[model samples]
Target: MKLTNKHFRIAEIMAAFFTGSQTEQDERDFEEWAKESDRHKAFVNRLLNPEEYEENRRALDKFQVEEAWSKMDKRIGDTKVRKLSSWRSVVRYAAVVLVLLSAGVYYWWNGEEVREEVPVLYQIAAGTTGARLTLGDGSVVDVLKDRAVELKEVDGTRIVTDSIGIDYSTRETVDTAEIMNTVQTLTGMEYMLTLSDGTKVFLNAETKLKFPTKFQKEERVVVLEGEAYFEVSKDVAHPFIVKTNGVEVKVLGTSFNLRSYSDENSIATTLVSGKVAMFAGENSEEIVPGEQAVYMKETGKMDVKPVDVTLYTAWHTGKFIFRNETLEEMMSYLARWYGVEYRFIDEGAKKLQIGARLDRYNNMNPIIEMLKKTGLVNITQVDNMLYISSTE
Candidate 1:
């Protein structure tokens, strides 16, 4: 029989089953198709293990994406001269085209073959150096790596772009209307900023930092929306304060990592050096180095506990250190940096706990492969969305 779109859909259903992401109805449909006829069963088996079809496997291995796209374009241009055949032929042609476009020969066709190799070269990549800077005068600037532009000269302070991030060193501390500036990092992007007072801020993905172009004499305060690692400059007279999500971190000449994502249940502040005081409404708590303060957004309650500082600060170092994190928790962090959507098939899969350290800068595919290898969870990528289910 000629290949059709039905065949391609059946292949996808088999994939979902192997990945453990198949719904109850999908499992029933798959089983019905398998028992329908001997030809259907054989086709499904070949899709499950493409090594059974040597010609197709070899064709996949030889398929070069760039050449395939060029050839497809030429074919499309010449389609008027040569009328295409039946829908079955079109489906077969489309299948081959999709296989070439999906990257890698093995993963596109065969499921078991993917088990032996790492498919980390995914379409979704990690965050890079880019941020939106809103200057004091209500003007915005896009700050990216190697894109240098002079922002402005507030009073005597000159805000300019350097090789890495924005730099503001030479500023006159004159009271020419206190100028407030905001820098925001979009999803799949991060940035570094050096404030006028030499305080360095390393912003994480989907974070925003609002500060003055030049700080007042009494205090240095910045409002944070998401997550950031701050290396506050030493000023005995002027204390540095970070306000975020109804909580504030007060410090003087210290470093800390603060995570205040809106989706999270609590705002976590981990001190790396010196000390930090976390305040929420009427309650407040003091935490020292190696300690974390978790402030619940709903109840406005703060709890201080000892934590591994490295786990909280690893994002800036191009690493993700998860210490016994749930599958849902891990995927939530991954989704932000990689700019992908994820869903668990069941509640059990979401709660499955695992511990692994991965290179945050790497693509999404390998990380999913690694998670699958652990036998804790099974992962399947449908377009940019990742579907996860319990291996049990």
Candidate 2:
């Protein structure tokens, strides 16, 4: 049977369920996704939780399950991608080799030692929100906790929460030399870290930020891959530095977001406050608030432009914002966040673009809703692939 996009989506959920949701958090996550929309829930019921569908969990796999589903993200009348979901679980025969290896690779062939790979990973089950953090210390922290755990307390630092928001006091502290290193997030996790200098760092999923627990006498710096946001602490004596995809952001005190996902083709740095000097391996430009710096990996080229800062940093606010973005771009984030599979079956579908914003931790129906509004496309799921087609 031809795999429809509906079937592909159903299979992604099944993969999440079959992969094992042993932890209490996992169970809660499944429930959250299960209740997001009637379509999503009904799809889950018909192809996943039922015993009948469970009986045929061997037909869904085609290397492009996620991409395929991106093709058929819309719904078809009574075609029941749900039915294909159960029968197609076993179809992915060749996916064993294509692991999305984001971390553990050096930013450069002869890069610094700080770029070594960490062993732990954060995986999000399908359709749920929140992420698990794997620290370099071999400790795991759940960032979604109602109250964040102070893994350790810095001397002379205090946490103050008010209408102005929480403040970390840096009255005084000893300059004891501790092992400073990089911390990378697994695919399912994003993180927020406060450096010794009081600079706040926000990480996107599967990003690695390598920094010292304490600053060296010479500099305070961190390397990144994937995406992260920074609210720089003021320090005239030293500066804050963020490294990603071979580009560097040097600032004395500022706030910005760096997006350099491995799966993505470009490295983007958006400045929200203060100022930023964005330098590729060579070219340099200064970016102020409301501006962005984009780096293309292939040509080592860059473009610094002005944009809506809110759109660039919206992901940090638990929102996925897209501004005239392409369908492929949206699907990439979906593949990571929802942990769903896709099959980009429509060659020309890549030309379709969208501009929308939806809650990061919310159900995915909103994305589909916007897709339907475009009127240029149609979606259907066959087995584990979503086939998006152009009306023209």
Candidate 3:
């Protein structure tokens, strides 16, 4: 059968799955497709077998490059091509041969000399769900998705941690005194928390949030050191307040994202639903849904503007949405989530603007390939560091 768009999509999904980057939805779709016929099930099983993988690799090594190139040339017209430099590149090309035996989509391999000068790019895995929880008694606990634990705070507040997240809803606070607890997520880690008041907070990588075991009768308040998306539980009498840097975001009952990393030049608060009032020093601004409040740390200036909230809030939904963000800014975000260091060899490359939406859970290979295909910059990995230079 001739390869159609659907076949290409399936191939892409298979590649993602083999690379350990397929999403939950991808797995479901793949399993559903594989159940359509016995042939499909057998093909998936063959791919999963270690011996079959070696056989496929050996077959790929003998694929005819010249004939395959001729066919590809006729399909896409004239196009310039460059020789791949390393076995890593060969493996990448070989991964494209999904359903090869049945679809007749040829795999091409040229026995060209390997170029040692070219850098080899390695895969960097995505972040996972984990955090450090510090109770009011000054005890630190490592909270991970795979583990389950139960603890009682000094204030008699009961905290339960399960696969979903840290839950503080079952409050058994005996003392009326305010007891503070903090949840911190390091680089390449994220976490979710259910506050005592039933509010849900999604903490991003490299973020820290400090809250009380039980809210005061007057108000609910939390201190933030990095970034988090909050869905505040509605309580008309007790307003929810998030304090970060010098800015304060106050909402009665709403959902919003606040980003205030120390390394970032500015703090941003993006409102997703309902209303929020952001205060910085003497200046205060109220932002409705689909709006953002930006507080410049250097200039002590606050500005409110309408924005596509998804660009700022997508992290809560497992996506990285960039809207013409500078390469330096984009890399900073990636570096925090991927736990990889990056340097721009060509200083000018740092200023290049990039606009794309990427799956936050995907490994670095596909993300790197997407960036390289943009023809804007060249990215190569050495150890855990990514060197970015101009395509020129």
Model 2: residues >4 Å from true position, as ranges?
1-144, 147-176, 181-183, 381-385
Model 3 regions lying over 4 Å from their true place: 1-120
Please give the distance, in angstroms, between residue 142's alpha carbon in candidate 3 and its true position after superposition: 0.4
- Lowest-scoring 10 consecutive residues by lDDT in candidate 1? 84-93
Q: Going through the candidates in order, what is the number of backbone clashes in each? A: 5, 44, 0
Number of the candidate with higher lDDT, 2 or 3: 3
- The C-alpha lDDT values of all candidates are 0.73, 0.57, 0.76
lDDT of 2: 0.57
What's the TM-score of each model vs. the native?
Answer: 0.70, 0.60, 0.70
Worst 10 residues of 3 by lDDT: 109-118
User: Compared with the true structure, what per-residue lDDT tens digits does model 2 show for residues 134-188?
Assistant: 4445665444523444444343333332222223433356555444445555555
lDDT digits (tens) for residues 297-340 of candidate 1: 88878889998899999999889999888888988888889999
Q: Using lDDT as the measure, what is the rank order of every candidate, best first?
A: 3, 1, 2
lDDT of each residue in 299-337, candidate 3, tens digit only: 999999999999998998999999999999999999999
Q: What ordering of candidates by TM-score runs from best to worst?
A: 1, 3, 2
